[model samples]
Target: MEEFIQEAYSGIFEKELVKEIAETAALIDFEEGDRLIEINDYIRSMPLLLNGAIKIMREDPDEGELLLYFLEKGDTCAMTLACCMGQTRSAIRAIAENKGSVVMIPVTKMEEWLGKYKSWRNYVFESYNKRLGEMLSAIDNLAFMHMDDRLLNYLKEKAKVNNTTVISSTHQEIAYALNTSRVVVSRLLKAFENDGKIKLNRNNIEIIAID
Candidate 1:
């Protein structure tokens, strides 16, 4: 995990600031199926993801979960920012999508770190900007795209984010992201799989090709 942090910082922060922040970080590991934070739950401190991914979702009338996006390594959870601003009842739910490690930083300590480390502060702002952009994009898709179109586009986007046409996520999870039902997702996925565009592996569905 230290290696991952070093790598993440090497790409994003000054070496000295990286060491300072890493030194102050306390690793919190979660198992694959853990629920790191539920809907509307508030955090007293901020957490930095060091390894693996978490799904950020909201409830929809059509389903169990609606995936807003993901918090990958080097990304901070949106809830952290919301909590910092003293907001209650987050519209997003954060669940551990896989085995992961988080660095929980006390809000006071984080403020001190930001004060002492200029580069780290800038890095945080840049990350938040990227997240805000993604949130806006999600809103745009939800407002304009058809459910099937959204699902296909989302799978395509996730493929791009992972740098491969193949990813190990599930139809139900994808449905959650699309704000639709897994049964409908399954029907579409079965057709895609039959058409040789993807393959299903238990809970994980891999898109083999887009075209």
Candidate 2:
């Protein structure tokens, strides 16, 4: 675990901090589609991604789920940080985008290290800033971008996170992420296929012309 921590976060965190994290954090593995955090759940620990990607999503009872952003290697969820600091329930859901592992640092240690380690403090603040920008971008996409453009961007992001051009998700799953109907997603996907941006597969969408 210490070796993994050193390999994943060596340059980002100081040596002493890394040692402390290895001593204090618990490593957990997750499979694709696993729910790491759920809405309204009390967040007990924060995750530091060592491998793979996690997609952060917002859910509304009436509007449904919306994908906020993807957290890859060397990234931590800022929303989780906020919940830990405020001792509040999670407002967003975190799902594994692929098979991965995370070092879960307890909330108690999160605050303790904040004052003890400079690198930890910087990481926390940077995470907050970065996540705030992503949330704002999500809002901007909904308010300004057309659904097709939004869908294209979503596909590109998904492809990038999973490290493949092939996205192994159903149309209905895409619809849920975009907070739209499956029919709408299908229509737009067919249009995308016709436009040579993607190829429709049985269960996955393959990127062709799309970057």
Candidate 3:
């Protein structure tokens, strides 16, 4: 865990604080399709992703699920902190996008670290800032972008975050993330393929071009 943190979060935290975090944090592994958190679930520990990616989704009771952003290596989940610190249940969901490990810090430790370590406080605020910016961008995309553009942007973001040109996902999965219908997603994807923007396979899409 320490070694992973050193590679991912080296300059963000002090050595001693990192050591303390390593001592208290539980090392947990998650597979590709695992749900790290669910709706209305109590957050006992806030996760700091050590490797791979976790997609954070916002679920509406009536509107269904929408992918908000991702918490990748060296990133923290601001929503988790908000829920845990407020003593409230989770309103969003977190799922592992790939197989990876996370360092879970207890809620008590989160509180203690706020006052005990300056680096911890800075980290938390930085997380809040970053997440808020991403949320704003999501809003912009939803409000102003067309479905094809939004879908393309989503695929590009996914590819960039995963560090791969090929994205393994189904039409239904893409539909769920974008809060649209599978048929609509499939149609747009086919159009993209015809336009030489992407190549569609059985369950994966290889991005050929973004522009």
Best by TM-score: 2
lDDT of 3 by residue, 13-44 (tens): 88988898889999999999899999899999
TM-score for all models, in order of appearance: 0.81, 0.97, 0.96
- Candidate 3 TM-score, true structure as reference: 0.96
lDDT of 1 by residue, 30-139 (tens): 97668777666766667788877777777876546656677877888655666755646566667776777888766666677677877768867887788888788788
Q: Which pairs of residues have clashing backbones in candidate 3?
A: none
Q: Where does candidate 3 have its weakest 10-residue lDDT segment? A: 1-10
The TM-score obtained by model 2 is 0.97
- Count clashing residue pairs in model 1: 2
Alpha-carbon deviation at 115 in model 1, angstroms:
2.8
Compute the lDDT of residue 54 as modeled in candidate 1: 76
TM-score of candidate 1 to 2 decimals: 0.81
- Greater TM-score among 2 and 3 belongs to 2
